[model samples]
Every structure is written in structure tokens, then in C-alpha cells.
Target: MAVARLGTVVLDCPDPLALAAFYAEIIGGKAEETEEGWVELTGHEGTPLAFQKSPGYVPPRWPAEDGSQQFHLDLTVEDLDAAETRVLALGAKAVDAGDPVRTWRVYTDIAGHPFCLCAC
Candidate 1:
């Protein structure tokens, strides 16, 4: 009864290869540049992700009044602390350091896209 199945989540960034590499590190995928200005990450656990080159890419701002964060990815992890440490070292900037009781923490990728590491 579903209209269609999900194909892939594509993001527009300045450099497709670089963004794909960043996500590949977090999601256990191998990034391959399939075509000019386009890169695909495969062999990952979850849904596939692809990156496309944008000439004048401007990242969205978090906690904006107008909901600048159009969308975000929620990644499930076992240990939030351990995952936080690894993502930080991979050039992800912390957007919100959730409280101790919180189950999720927010961060921005190299391209400034918001994503959450949720404790599972």
C-alpha cells in the first residue's frame, strides 16, 4: 500500500566528496565519487546517503527563529558519550550539549548540517 520506497537522502553541499567522507566515517560506509559533483556512500547499515555539489551552498542555522534547520538526521548509538567524543574529533561542532538526563545530543557536520546522536 506504500506509494514508493525511499531511495536515498541526498544533501547539497559545496563539496560532495568531502561531505560524503565525513558521513562515511560516522555511518560505516564507503564513499565513491560516481560522477562530477556527485558522490554516493554505500555499504552502510542504514539508509544510503548521497551528496551533491552546490555552487553557493549556505548552511542552515540551528535554534533559529524561523526554523532554519530544515531537516536533521537522528543517529542511534549505544553510548552517547563515546559517540560524542568520536564525532567531535571528526570536525563536528557541538550545537547543543544536552543535559546529563537527556538521551540525545546535537551536532553540526563539516557542512553545518544538524544531526543528533541519540542513545539507544
Candidate 2:
């Protein structure tokens, strides 16, 4: 038997509710405010994502030494082009990694957390 199972991935941001809502919309879930500065997205078709407020939160500067991204999420999609359009409309900033033919593309969320949309 396994010693443990994955629960939720919590992200620190300036606004918990907003971050929770953003992930909820992308991942198919409902955002619930448990308390001030805390929110949870549950019932997603995938894993649950939670958000916690950090007053001094500094968005990670991807591709840079200072405040570099700690981690990222890779989401598989059937249609990369379509997904990219939608994500961009939802405030995702595409990262110019200069590998157009790759199976995955990187983007940063509103709070500057790096994530990827993968075709594989």
C-alpha cells in the first residue's frame, strides 16, 4: 500500500479568491472561500488546486535567477491552438521559449505561475 496520496496543490498569491477562480475556470471546478485569504477549488475533473494569500507575494520571474519559478503544471490538450487562444483570453501570458515545434508550450498565470499546455 502507498504511504500517502496526493491531496491538493496549493499556490500562494496576492488574492486567493482570484487565483482559485482562475484555476477553477481552467480546470473545471468550483471555487469556495474557506476563510479570509484562503480559497479552494474542488470537484475539478482533475486534481484540486488551492490558493492562499501572501501579502508579500512576488511573482516568480521565469527564465531569470531572481525569483525564478518554483514549479509548473503541465496540462494535456487535444488541440493546442484552440487551448492557447482560450488561455490567452483568460489572462495567460505565453512565454517565448523559441521552440515552436515542441509538444508543449509555456505560459504564466495571472499571478505569474508558470504552466504548460501539452499536446502529448
Candidate 3:
């Protein structure tokens, strides 16, 4: 038997509403600011994603410069080329860090958190 089940993954960001909005845009859901500086996204197919305000939130450096990335989201896309174009329009910045394979690409949200668009 399982002791406990997994819950929503919460991300710390300078602007909870903005970060949550970003994810909601890609994930197809509504981002709700339920409380002061706290936001939650739902109505998607899988686990929920939430955002919490960090007063002194310093965005992570992808190559781990000033601070290392603690975690990242891996999102599957049907068409990498199409998704890339759309995400970029939605304020996602592609990371130039060397990716040997063409199966996936790296990008950062407006808040500078790393995520991947995987074709697998």
C-alpha cells in the first residue's frame, strides 16, 4: 500500500500570478490567485501546478552560475518546431546550451526557470 500520494508541484517565483499564468497558458488551464501572493492552476489532465510568492526570489542560472536549478519541468510536445514557435511567442526564451539530440529542447519561462520540450 502507498503511504501517501503525490500532490501539486509548487514553484517559487517573484511573481506567483505571472509564473502561474505562464504555465497555465502552455498547460491549458486557468490560473487563479487564491490568496495574497499565491496562485494555483488546475483543469488540466494531470497533476496540478501551483506558484508561491518568494519575496527575495532569485531566478536560477541554467548552467548553475550564481545559483543552480533545483528542479525543472519536462513537457512533452507533439511537434517540437511548432511548440517552440508558440512558446517563444508566449515569452519563453530558448536556452542555447548544447543539446546533442534533436529529441528535446530547453527553454526558460519568463521567470527564468528551466523547462524542456521533449518530442519523445
Candidate 4:
């Protein structure tokens, strides 16, 4: 049996509202800020995604030999090329680890958190 029900997945970032807006664009949600300064992406299907304000935030490094990537979100999309283009336009920088053959491409958000757009 499960110990508890999952509530929401929260990410720590410098600007909660900004990060929320960025993910909202990609995942189809409305970025709503709370009185506590935390931002939540609402009205989307699946598990909820929220952002918390973290002062002096330092984003994790991806593809590091030391395994610096603490965590990452894998977003499945119908069109990988289109999604990559759109995310890049939204200030997502691509992380080229030099692996040519792969179904998923890595990218970092404006706040520098690593994420991937996997082909569905």
C-alpha cells in the first residue's frame, strides 16, 4: 500500500513566477502566484508543478562527470523538432552532450534547470 498520496512536484528557482510562466508555456497551464511568493502552474493535466522562491539559487550542472544533475523533468512530445524550436525561443538553452543517437534532447530553462523533450 502507498504511504501517502502525491501532492505536487515543486521546483526551487530564483524567480518562481518566471519559471512557472516558462513551464506553463510548454505544458499548457496558467502561472498563478500565491501570497507566499510561490508560483503554481494550474489547470493542467497530470501531476501539478509548482515553483518555490529560492534565494541565491544555483542551478545544477548537467552531463557532469560528478553527477551534478540532482533531478530533471522529462516531457514527452509528439514532435521533437517543433518542441525544441519552441523551447529554444522561450530561452531554453540546449545542452549538447555530443550523443547524436538519442530520442530525447536535453535543455535548460531560463533559470538553468535541466529538462528533456522526449519523443512520444
- Which structure is stronger by TM-score: 3 or 4? 4
For 1-120, candidate 1 gives per-residue lDDT tens digits of 999999999999998988998998998889999999999999998888999999999998897788668989999999999999999999999999779799999999999899999999
Least well predicted 10-residue stretch by lDDT in candidate 1: 60-69
Residue-wise C-alpha lDDT for candidate 3, range 1-120, written one tens digit per residue: 999999989889899988887888887899898999889997887888999999998878886876667899999988888888888999999995245557888899999899999886
Query: Which of the numbered candidates is closest to the native, going by highest TM-score?
Result: 1
Which 10 residues in a row give candidate 2 its minimum summed lDDT?
61-70
TM-score of each: 0.96, 0.89, 0.89, 0.92
What are the lDDT figures for the candidates, one per model? Answer: 0.92, 0.85, 0.86, 0.89
Ranking by lDDT: 1, 4, 3, 2
The alpha-carbon RMSD values of the candidates against the true structure, listed in the order shown, are: 0.9, 1.8, 2.0, 1.6
Q: Score residue 115 of candidate 1 by CA lDDT.
A: 95
Candidate 2, residues 15-84, lDDT tens digits: the string is 8988887877777788899888889888877777889999999887777776557798988888888888
Candidate 4 lDDT by residue in tens digits, 1-120? 999999999999999989999999999989998757699999998899999999978888887787778889999999888998999999999996235567899999999989999888
List ranges where model 2 is wrong by over 4 Å: 66-68
Write the candidate numbers in order of decreasing TM-score.
1, 4, 3, 2
